[model samples]
Target: MRKFIAKTVEEMPPSGIRKFFDIASEMKDIISLSVGEPDFVTPWNVREAAIASIERGYTHYTSNHGNPALRRLIARYLRERYGTSYDWKTQTIVTVGASEALDLAFRAVIEPGDEVLVPAPSYVSYMPGVAFAGGVAVPIETKECDGFTVTAQALEAAVTPKTKAIILPYPNNPTGAVMTKEQLAAIVPVIEGSDLFVISDEIYSELTYGGRHCSIASFAEMYPRTVVINGFSKAFAMTGFRLGYAAGSEEMIAAMVKIHQYFMLCAPTASQHAGEEALRHELDTDFAQVNKMVSDYNRRRTFVYNAFKKMGLSCFEPRGAFYVFPNISGMGMTSEEFCHKLIHEKHVACVPGTAFGAAGEGFMRCSYASSMDNLKEALKRIAEFVDECRK
Candidate 1:
């Protein structure tokens, strides 16, 4: 019997989210706030565009870089939303969600054993994807004290002789903490003189509240070294469509597209068209619906924060995204233990913060992406559990 496995494949552990989701599946009567997707459907115009594209028999693959129209639309979308310009022909590459874009970016740039910096409590893919591409994942802890902003000092401390790139996961996952322009500028000087690339995962770029989202790519000097990874999943509730795009300098975009060409060929043709339509027509029209969701989430955020405060479990007030990463060290339990017990005993399903990284310990990520009704039920269960634990 052959038991051959690559060292990289063997070293990789299963995702923490999948582990908890799997455990929750066997538990009965659970109210889960562990999901990471938006609760809204893809808006009407976007759906129509996809269907219309299909009806017109645009079923085949377009090109290695995806449909030209979508690329240009993405350029316009980025420009209008973040005030960044990406030349459609030379700088944009559509991908199979942001997932493939991440893979391709790593493949394009990472050399074997090259050091890649990743902040704690970030999206799960950065580490494994970098490792699979033969890059070392250097996990840096970004504490809640600084609103999860990666400071220039912290970044400078993490960089080494072998460091090749840094993953900036903002409007960050499982934290909902956003970086302000001032905070973003705080790290600019660190990379200004370096040869390292910045792989900014702006997946939740549009979900921001309070201030407009800023792109690291907006800085002209850093522009050449920045690769912007964003998608339709979080912003427009188009997860199933699986369309995302990356924009960067010509050399880097072309390098990424080379891997994308041999690997994915093209993103789903229909979905790409729908996404183009999403950028062109539905964004402004759907802002009301999008804002409604944001407003609802803000209300839910206040409720959860207040409830937790009464229970003596204060968490950061999330500014963007739909997650609340609460430090539950006061609960006197490991995050996994707390989450598992909550699922089985209290009938509530929330993810252990350690699912994001070691620095994520002593906390739990409760997402408000699910319905408010579910949130209410989960909070009641949580209160009951808190009372029982206290006793």
Candidate 2:
């Protein structure tokens, strides 16, 4: 059986984030903050749209590209919200989730032995996806002092003739770091100079704080080479619906759709209907529900940042997304050791930083997407645990 399995599939380890989550699940009274899911239910209007779709017998498969109406709305939403333009008919695709859209991007662009630059401490799926696509995943480490942004110097240094693309995981998972337009501009010279394509994951775009989210695709030079991957999961709290989309040039999207049509056929019809409604309602009401959720997340973000600061932990204040990456290096333990002790001793669960990438070795990620009461109690226990560690 071992010999029959592909070496790549057999050698891969299970997700580091999920291991602790599974452990915490079996324990009593554990407050798990490892997963990056939104706490809110899908907005009522979105869910109602899905129900109406089902009632209308729209349960069958949609076009391989997704529902035409949904694709149009996605194009409009991206253009209006992030200044990215795509032709819905030829340059967009509906995927199972941003996860699948990412996979499709890799498969479409990568040939055997091609290299894809991934910023370190990025989403866990990235390196593996590149590997499965027969590409090398070259990690470029982003520093905490720089807000975990990929600098122009770093991007320039990482590129080689073999490099085919780079994954821009802004509003980054595990770190919650976001790049401002100016920061993004600094790297544009490098990208324009190279043949490298861009895969921008903006799933957390709507949750940004202190500023609006900026897409690399908004750059005239980058727009043609960038595949912007986003979805309703993070903002609309529709993770269970498992829908996402990718927009790029017609050529790239056509190649991706070729692969996606054979593999996924299409995204869920009912979910597409729901997504259309989500975007439509957002546009019509000026993102009232989404803004409400973002406001609540901002409150939690402030509370968590202050809590960590009071504990004397060095935490980078997050500008986007709901997670905080706090340096636990001063605790004199490895990231896993710190998380293990904290969870076992305090019954509060969070992820080890090393789970993200080697650059995350001295940190740990804590999601602030939980209820305020839960966050308050968890922070209290975490404070006590930190004091005990010092002693």
Candidate 3:
């Protein structure tokens, strides 16, 4: 039975993030700041729309590319928000969250021996996604001194003849780093005049604190080669809905759709209906509720960043998303050891930065997505643990 398993599937490393989570789950009195999903419930209107869709008998399979109404609304959302345009009918394919969209995009474009450049301290999925598509995952490490933003020099140095794509995850997950227009512009020359595709995962686009999110696809040169991966989970508090879509050139999207058609058939019928309502109802109204959620997250973000500084931990102030990566090297322990001890001894849980990449060592990712009360208590426990470890 063991020999029957595929080598790739067997050899892949188990998720380091999940290892701590599983331990914390069985423990008592643990304050978890490891999970990344928003603690907020879905907006009432979106939930109601899904209920209505079910009542109206929208439970059957939809078109392989997803509902036209949802696709068109997504296109409009992109245009209004990012000032980018794509053919709703041919250039967008709604899948089961951005996770599936990423897989489909990689499978559609990658071949054996191709190389996909991924920035380090990234979401844990990108590397495995590339490998699952029979492509090599090349990690270009970004540092805290540089604010974790990838530059053209680093990107160009990593590119080889086999380079086929690049995974750009901004408003980044563990680091919570956001790339501004100028930052993105600096990398344009490296991508321009090349055949490399840009898989820009902007799932956290709406949660930026400094300014509006900038899409790589907004640039003229990058647009033709960029596949913008976005979803309802992060922005609308719809994680369980598992709804996301990809936008790209007609040819690329068509290829992805073919893979999606056979692999997933279609995204959930009710989720598609709910997604449309999210855009048409909440988003069209200037995102009143969504804006409120963002405000709350900002408050938590500030509190957590200040708390880390007060504790003498060196951490970059995150400008987007709901995480803070605090350097833990001074604690004289590996990130995994620190996290394990913190949870077991202090009853607080945070993900080790090494969960993201080897470059993330000496750091720990603490999500501020929990309530203020929870965050305050967790920080207090963490402070006690830090002090105890100091001596």
Candidate 4:
């Protein structure tokens, strides 16, 4: 059996985040703050559009790059919101979700022995995806003092002859860190002369609690070199639709679409219709509903932030994303140890920081994606568990 498996596939580590989520699932009484997804249902209008498409006998494969209408909508949305523009026909490719876009982006550009610089405490998928594409993932640590953002100096230091690309995941998962315009601008000059490409995962772009989400691709120098990955999962609560898209320079998008053609054929036809609707004013209506969701998330964000502060745990104030990563080192326990003891003793489930990367070992990621009541209860249980550990 071992001999039959591909060496790379077999050597890959199982997802660290899912291990604790599986444990929590089997427990009798558990409050799960472990999953990184929206608790909100897909907006009624978006869902209805999909159903209507199917009912209208429109259930067929779209173009490999996805429906032209949806792609145009995606392109326009990015331009109007972030000031970045990509040609809908040649520079955008709809994907099965940002997951597939990320995978395709890696496969399209990475060559054997190439090194992709990934900032630490990132989404768990980036490293494995790079490895599967025969590229090495070089981790650049982002410090808490720097809001977990990789500085230009650090990025320059990580560059080597083998360095081929960089993975910039903002409103970052696990850490909830966001890179400001100035911070992103600082790195532009650093990589200006280098031949490195960038894969910017801005899936949580719409969930930022800050003024506005800025894309590294918005910079004139970075635009040509960056591939932007975004989707409807976080903002529109459309995860089940399994729809996302990638925007890059025309050449980069064409390469990714070639891979997408052979593997995925096309994204779900009905879902593409829904995606177009998601971008239209009809769905969000001045974004009042989306704003409401953000407001609620902000409330829960404050709850978790204050709860950790009250518990005397050290945590960085996250300006984006729904997660709060708190350093639990003072409890004298490894991240895994603290999480395991917490779930068993308090029946409150949160992911260990180590789940994100080795640098996350002294912390834990608690998502506020759960309901307000659930978040409050989970916080209470965590407080009690910390107190008991202290005693």
Candidate 5:
């Protein structure tokens, strides 16, 4: 059996994020913050749309590219919001989730031994996805001092002739870091010089605070070479629907659709109908529901940041997404050790920073997407645990 297993599949480690989540699930009275899911239910309008779709017998498969209407809406939404344009008919693909869109992008572009630059402490799926696509995942460490952004210097240093593309996980998962337009511009020259393409994971795009998210695809020079990945999961709280999309050059999307057609056939038809409704309602009402959720998340983000500060932990103030990455280095334990003991001692679960990448060694990621009461209780327990560690 062991000999029959593909070496790559067998050797790859399981997700570090899920390991603690599984452990926490087995324990009683645990306030698990290990997952990055939105606590809110999918907006009523979106859910109702799915119901209507099912009633209308939309249970069958959609076109391999997705529902034409949904693809058009996605293209419009991206262009109106980010100043990027795409031809829905030829430059878009609907995937199982942003996760699949990511995988498709990797499989579409990568050849054996090609390198994909991943910013460290990024979403866990990235490196593994690259590996599964037979590409080398080269991690470029983003620093706490630089607000967890990939600087031009670091990106340039990591690139070699083998490098084919880079994954831009802004509104980053563990760190909640976002790149401003100016920050994105600084790296354009390097990307242009290397002739490398980009996979911009903007799953948390709508969850940004302080300012709007600036997509790299909005840059004229980069737009042609960038695949922008996003979906309904984060903003609309539609994770269970398992729908996401990718938009880019016609060539890139054609390649992705070729792979997606054989592998997934299409995203769920009912989900695509729901996604279309979500976007239509958002556009009509100016994103009223999504804005409300973002506002609530902002409140939680502040609470979490302040709680960490009061507990004497060094935490970067996150401006996007719902997670906070706080440095737990002073606790005299490794990230895994600290997380393990905290969950056992306080019954409050968080993901170890090392789960994200090697650069996350001294940190831990806590999602603020829980209810206010849950967050309040979790923070109180965490503070007590911090004091106990100090003693």
Candidate 6:
């Protein structure tokens, strides 16, 4: 018998989050905090728009770049929210989701053996997408001492001759780390003269705390070399809608569209209609609701952070997004070990930090996207587990 394997497909491991779900599925009365998805339903207006579009027979495949109305709306939304603008006709393209946008961005620029610098414990897609596109993923660990944000010093140290791009994940997934405008400014000088481009994932841009999101695209010099990937999933709780988009220099965006067309002809037709309302008319009202969700999550963050802090766990306070990435190194177990023991022993399920990347060892990511009742209950179980660990 011959072994069949391809370097690309074989190298990719199973999803870190999926493993927890699989294990939790078999357990009775499990409380899972491993989810990275939003728990909210799509807003009423957005859903109604999609339903109306479908009723009107707008079910056919749209233009490869997406419906023109949606593209225009996306461009408008970017300008309104992030102070970054793209030409709808020439610079924006909608895709299946931010996942597909990430895939397209990596495929657009990465080639065999090229090095891609990624700040660690990012959203699960970055390194894998790069690797899948035949690029090497070089993980640069961001320290909790610095709120898990990448500094210019870190970015400069990670780059080399083979480095072609950096995947900047601000309002980060697992860590909830956010870079200030000043913090982002620090890295611009490092890449000023390099041929490196930036792939900025701002999916969590709207979920940010009071401070507005700063786009790398706002930097005129960087605009030509940066591709911005964003979506309705995180911001509008439109996860199941599977609508996302990317904007960049026309040349790069066109290349991404070419690849997108050959793979996914267009995003869901009804989604494009819903996306139009989201970008143009509904965002302000919908984002108010999004902000309310963030406020609720912030309250839970305070509650959970205190729980870990009271237990003498080293937890960095997250400034944005809805996760609490507590450093569990003091617990004297690897993140995976701690997660498994907690789930099996105490019926609480949270993801190990190492699942995100090697640099994430000894940490655990907990999503506070659940109700306070569930969250408080999970923490009580965790307290009991910690007491046992200490024994």
The lDDT of each candidate is 0.86, 0.94, 0.93, 0.91, 0.95, 0.88
Per-residue C-alpha lDDT of model 6 across residues 207-288, encoded as one tens digit per residue? 7776888888899888899999989898778888999999999999999999999989999999889988777655556567
Expressed as tens digits, the lDDT of each residue in 354-379 for candidate 5 is 99999999999999999999999999
- Number of the top candidate by lDDT? 5
Clashes of 3: 0
Candidate 5, after superposition: displacement of residue 278 in Å?
0.4
Query: Of the candidates numbered 4 and 5, which has the greater TM-score value?
Result: 5
RMSD of each: 1.5, 0.7, 0.8, 1.0, 0.7, 1.4
The local distance difference test score of model 2 is 0.94
After TM-score superposition, the amount by which residue 202's alpha carbon in candidate 5 deviates from its true location, in angstroms, is: 0.5
Instruction: Check candidate 3 and list the clashing pairs.
Output: none
- Among residues 3 or more apart in sequence or in different chains, the pairs in candidate 2 whose N, CA or C atoms overlap within 3 Å are none
Candidate 5 least-lDDT 10 residues: 41-50
lDDT of candidate 1 over 105-186, digit per residue (tens): 9999899989999999788888999999999999888977888879888899999999989999888998888888778787
Misplaced by over 4 Å in model 5 are: none
Error of 3 at 248 (Å): 0.6
Please state the error at residue 91 of candidate 6 in Å. Answer: 0.6
TM-score of 2: 0.99
Give the TM-scores of the predictions, in the order they appear. Answer: 0.96, 0.99, 0.99, 0.98, 0.99, 0.97
Candidate 5 accuracy as lDDT: 0.95
Task: Write model 3 residue lDDT over 1-391, tens digit each, in one string.
Answer: 9899878789989887788788889989988999898999999889999999999988999999999999999999999989999999999999999999999989988999999999999999999889889999999999999999898888999999999999999999899999999999999888875578999999999999979999999999999999999999998999999999999999999999999888799999999999999998865689888899999999999999999999999989999888999999999999999998999898898999999999999999999999999999999999989999997
TM-score of 6: 0.97
Model 1 bad stretches (over 4 Å): 283-286
